[model samples]
Target: MLSPFDAHIDAELAQAVATIAHLRRALEETSTPGEAEEVLDLFEKLLRDLERVKPTVIGRTRQHGASWDAVGRSIGMNKDAARKKYNTNNVQRALARIQDGRPATPHPQRAPVHP
Candidate 1:
């Protein structure tokens, strides 16, 4: 089983990815500013938490991000675990790309639309 720190890092990374995905989708569809702000808030928090976790690895936990799966699976995670972990890095990169006015991945969960 992976240590608590590893698990914590993986969770934080996953949340970051999912949040980014959502925000990206919202921007593409011209979502309302209020909804976009909500996702942005969550995304910002995830980024901050990720920076905190990045330096928490004290030993073999320092392996590449690919190692996040085994750590997650040991804690009952599923296939999305791996994809989600890598997406964390991808999320940040994609965000940068979008900020630079480039295309990014379409998010599966976009912010709710109002009538």
Candidate 2:
């Protein structure tokens, strides 16, 4: 069965696509290479930030009740891949923090995943 988190992810992805489309339009209207380059650089930075935060986002979503299946569909993967990639030791630490009533720390962008 489909999960509600999948719907949320779909909506977010749609919004992201719309935002990128608008950015592309603005980029095409830039009159100078310098201006276009600046926009391009910012766009690339945004993508990098998104990639960096993806694992944290997925972990937090799971903490808040999203299933791996939903997360996998959201990112175009399967359940096992999603958990294998995102639910590493860092996530466990974060989850423990929440359970122990401590503020969550910023997780490293990636952690070693164990079988």
Off by over 4 Å in 1: 58-115
Off by over 4 Å in 2: 1-29, 90-115
Question: Please, what is the whole-model Cα lDDT of each candidate in the order they appear?
Answer: 0.54, 0.64
TM-score top scorer: 2
* Tens-digit lDDT string for candidate 2 (9-114): 4544665676587678868789976667656655764465456446556866886799889999999999998888787686666445545756454433433233
TM-score of 2: 0.52
Q: What value does the lDDT take at residue 86 in candidate 1?
A: 38
Return the top candidate by lDDT: 2
| Model 1 lDDT per residue over 15-84, tens place | 7788788767766765677766666666665566555444333222434544555655653666476446
Number of clashing pairs per prediction, in order: 0, 0
> What TM-score, computed on C-alpha atoms, does each candidate reach?
0.39, 0.52
